[model samples]
Target chain A: MELLNRAISGTMESSDIMVEIIPWDKDLEINLKSDVKEQYGKQIIALVKAILDENGVKKACINLKDKGALDFVISARVKTALYRAARRSQ
Target chain B: MFDNFSKKYIYSQNTRGRKTTSDFLKTLGLSFDENVNITINILDGKRIIATASAEKNLIKCIGVDENYRSKGLMNTLISEIISHQYDNNIYDLSIITKIENEKVIQSLGFETICETENIILMENNKNKFKKYLENISKNKVANEQSSAIVMNLNPITKGHMYLIEKASKESEQVYIFIVSEDKSKVPFETRVKLAKESTKFLKNVKIIEGGDYIISSKTFPTYFSKNVDEWINNYCNLDLKLFGKYIAKELNIRKRYVGKEPYCELTSFYNKKMKEILPLYNIQVTEIERLEKNQKAISASLVRKLAEEGNISQIKELVPEATYKYYISKED
Candidate 1:
């Protein structure tokens, strides 16, 4: 399903990632603002890209404001944001 | 002790290497806003001792190392930001800080405008904003039924013209504030010129600059943020609240005119928020249906697309004569 509107999930608090998804014309632009960018940035991006590819989100802008969130937290936040963007709970 | 301290502008790519600036912001419990345009960092031989950032007209995230506090580094940082803003033709500067740091900012000639329990909003040029309002009020011939429209006429189309004309006819005086942020494909100078020429026939309309207070990157950074939903609600609330509480009162504006947003979700959300919030301040929100052609809404984005494709014939139908002429001249 196409992303209908802009949506966000999670918060800026510790151990969580605030994921925001917005519609885009072409390509997926992933911007990550993380506290641990030097150590875990690449891993986080890979996880998010895998999730987007799985969900068939081809053209969208995804922004992750991460505060030391683990892979599981990142996955949950991205899933929630995508669901919210598509206007579906699941 | 301060001999090694050197001030420099922080570019986006260089931010990672500037650990001192990042550490300073982190210590103050402030996240480094990636949208920061002008940043002044005082480094003591690669150690960031003091730092301040100005997004547009609002200065924020100012922090100094505890070791350098009593030596007046904060004052220097604030002064530098002020000078930077002034150099950019931004006269109305504001800073939002915790109540504890209020006195420090106040010492640098900023006066408190509004205060909540946790934060205080101070401005360096409250008098300038007030004076601007007074000038508008004094010059307005029909102040009895005044209205306002804050718009970014990126490339003024017939839709913008329609809204402005409607507002001009309905109110005794209409203040058309062109958004001054230069983040558009069409430069601010060109947009302002096109808007002025397009609405020259409307006698009751007075065109002015929005002046960093309305829909600015400082208050509403959604325009730049790819994640439009993240901070839009909070920023829009703060922006509209500032308008309702201060700007509306100062200019005696009782009504605001906006175009109906049917395409962009962010704009639609902004309109909804305006309708819900403006009434409390007694400023009525009037959202006019957008002009359409061929069953499609006429928008600046459409005009831009047509221009990019070199479709002048179709572009002529969507834009006003002034915009058409401007585009034609640019083609030459």
Candidate 2:
């Protein structure tokens, strides 16, 4: 789905991730910040990419500030933000 | 210890929590921070434990109870503030914190833009500074003997023109960085336009927007508003150090220029502080006497007053042609 406007979901509280989506013209860009960068950064990025692909989202800038959120929480936030941001059908 | 806490997002529209938050901030050696449009407080069932706030793009008044250290509350506080700003579509946010409180803010993914002994300015967006350097460095000539001036230009005046002309005559290149903060009756865009149009004829003079680096005289960080007089010097030194450390080096600026203030003691003190500090960075400081008419220095504030009160021809002698045209057209 294509994004209509900028939408954001989630919070920066502990064990939660703040996800922000901006409509982009180029390739998909995911900026992830996590304290566990060495151990789980790749896994987190892969999960987000898969979620975006599952929802057919392309050309969106996703900003994630992860405070050690589990995989499921990350996926939920991304999908919710994407769904809210998606362009409507004619 | 962190088990029984609830967080509340308080803003101006619903100020139910402002008084408590203000008192809470006071106990932690920080003020309630006047003019903060958004604030978030972590409450221990009515007693405040931690809090943070933002006034537009700048964040201040972050405090967590001393007993609550190492429980991840600071991170939550900062992240909440970022999320608040993000919700407002403010992606580029920054905080001016004392050097002692540096680590907590840095841990929340803000990189230091510039740091001095007492003050450190940090920002969340990493790309802003990089792009600023790229844009300003485009005008960098081969010579390192370049000079720079950061001006507020409330409205470009003849005094400003004379100062820029002096720098143009002496320096290999002159960069005019128009201050970006919008606190004046004259909006930032109009000020920048006036500065540009007035200096269009100076051959080697280039105009650049000051962005987040150049601190304006209007924005004395509310972080240090508690000690008003003392922090003024600190703020001025902070700006000069930013020039000497990054901007001057990037543009090969070796000398800095200023218009001597015959009025406004605060600005006079700023000139005094610049002379004292810029020398330590090995950047020469030149103070040009104000351009005068009728034996009085032409002041930007007086012109703004005259323009607003329908005194167009009176200020004609004070401002340049570009600025005079702007005010005259507005009169009609």
Candidate 3:
């Protein structure tokens, strides 16, 4: 799926992740700002990357501002952000 | 001791579970507004030990737990907030601190520009702004009869070009300050490029970067935030005041030009505020009616929507020739 426009999902609340996806022409670029970066940063990035790969998203810029969200919350936020970027509800 | 301390950005909606955050700020005789663009809280095992809030250009309501005083927690929290602002491309930051906490913030690279008995207003990059003014003065072709127009030009459309063209015709010289904040989907570089390319024919138009001074994330974060009418009013007032006090005087701008916005409520409100505020600084405000196409307003947002829908032909109609060419080149 290709991003059609700039779409933002989620909130900055604790246990939540705010994800913003913008259309990019090059490779997938992810920038993460997390409170729990010292602990589970790598795992969170891997989860987001896996979700994007599963959706077949090739060129997009993803910005996530995390407030100690769990893996499931991170995955759900990424999926919703991508869906919104692609202008699809699912 | 520092290992247990972690700083995190807190959302305003989470206030329900974080009563202590407000209570902590209140204990220090500071009030927190709901319009804060970013709030960083230093936590010690789930207890808020220190907090800092930034609204547009002003950083205020800094409170540290009494027990954590002089432990370098305030400095650390402020550093984090400053770093966050810089990442968002806001280099110039201002803070209004109480007389007691003035030295602490001053030590963190904020110079006291104005001081009252109760509060001190300090800002970073004070010398940089002065240098910017000096540079503009040196290259300024505009005399006292000059007018200024500050625009985002998210993707310079015919509407923006029309406004610039009108301003140039009316004033001896028009200073076109492109909003430097990178809040738009169109990057600042591309926006500036399109504005310059589209307006290259206007010899009386002086294109300059607005830098972090005008309509910046520091001064107008409400423009990017969710629809909060009150926040928009508050931040817009602050930004316009800064323009009236500093920008207008330095550039000798006698008039400010703006497009009449009939669509966005926030922009209309800002225009109304400009009408109210600029007069106090002896500057007149002129609003030109927006250009139209097919009986509708020609706006950059509309052009962006067309581009998003991949309606390149429709975008070509809304934007200037230079902008259309640039987008077409990008597609290749």
Per-residue error (Å), model 3, residue B259? 0.8
lDDT, candidate 2, A23-55, per-residue tens: 889899988887887899999999999988887
What digit string (tens of lDDT, one per residue) describes model 1 on residues B88-108? 656457887657888777655
Tens digits of per-residue lDDT, candidate 1, A44-82, equal: 999999999999999998867676888999999999889
lDDT of 2 by residue, B1-332 (tens): 26688888998876568888888877865677667889988888878899888888888788889988778887777767776786687878888877887777766767888887788888877788778878778878777689999898998898889999999999889999988877777888999888888888888898888887787566666554467676777788788887787778888888989988877788788888888888888889999998888898887888988988989999888888989999888878
Q: Write the per-residue lDDT of candidate 3 for residues B1-332, one digit (tens) a residue.
A: 37888878876677753456667776765556666777888899888889887876668667788998887676566666765765565646787555687877765556776554455557864676677667667657747778999888888998988899989888898888888876687898888888888888988888888875676423343322233555555566667776787777777888999999888766788889899988988889999999999999998888888878878888987888988987788677
Whole-model Cα lDDT of every candidate shown, in order: 0.77, 0.82, 0.76
- Which one wins on TM-score? 2
Model 1 alpha-carbon miss at residue B245, Å:
3.1
Worst 10 residues of 2 chain B by lDDT: B216-225
In model 2, the Cα lDDT at residue B126 comes to: 74
Q: Model 2 off-target regions past 4 Å?
A: A4-7, A21-32, A57-63, A87-90, B1-24, B32-35, B44-49, B65-71, B141-144, B225-230
Q: Which regions of candidate 1 deviate over 4 angstroms? A: A1-90, B1-37, B43-50, B55-57, B60-73, B80-93, B97-101, B114-120, B216-231
Better of 1 and 2 by lDDT: 2
